[model samples]
Target: MPLLPPWFHVRLTFGDGAVVDARAVVSEGRITIGDLSAGPPAPPDGHTAPADFAGPARHRARPSWPRGREGRRLVAEAYRAAQSEGRDPVLAVMRETGRSRRRSLRLVAAARDAGLLPPRHNRH
Candidate 1:
């Protein structure tokens, strides 16, 4: 198995030559999506400016947001399923989908906030 730095991003090539980014964990020699790999280090303070200021900057980059409603639904479903199984939804999400805790948390929170899961009173 190839060793990668926590901050390193990985792209996997399948047998058909199609490539996909590997997620948090790699199991059984298969590159799974949503692995908990480390993210890039935070930028120096000098690199950031006050939010009120508007101007062109040397380094212009923004994190990618989640996709359409379908993606959101998928995340919600995953969270609800995990919670119902008597596991930490976030941890189960990480194990099954390979997403980082941060990513899984976002999904869980979104589902909870949206009332996707049944009320606690309903669960025995």
Candidate 2:
């Protein structure tokens, strides 16, 4: 058997100390690409992010809770989602828009009392 040309491998690096390895092949008018790995190659066991980015981000760019009226609206939406599924949900406020759990909880209660959720009926 004989091997052909048109295959290439290249390494790319970024100023931030990141790197990616690329492999490509073009044969008979068809092209194929291999896996691209970014940054330092992952360990055999698994891949991991820096400690500060290990899990859900709690970054300064976004505050945990919005202020005043906007915060109210954010929590209301979360509360609505929570009620629909018959349980509390992590709203954009909690996970993205950024609202404190305590604040979100209070706002949720307010929205509920304000008629976001249907009235409860006691059952025996």
Which candidate number has the best lDDT? Answer: 2
Candidate with top TM-score is 2
Clashes of 1: 8
The parts of candidate 1 lying over 4 Å away from their true place are: 1-66, 118-124
Alpha-carbon local distance difference test for all models: 0.58, 0.63
Q: Which stretches of candidate 2 lie over 4 Å from their true place?
A: 1-6, 40-63, 66-70, 73-106, 112-124
**lDDT for model 1:** 0.58
TM-score of each: 0.35, 0.39
Q: What is the Cα-based TM-score of model 1?
A: 0.35
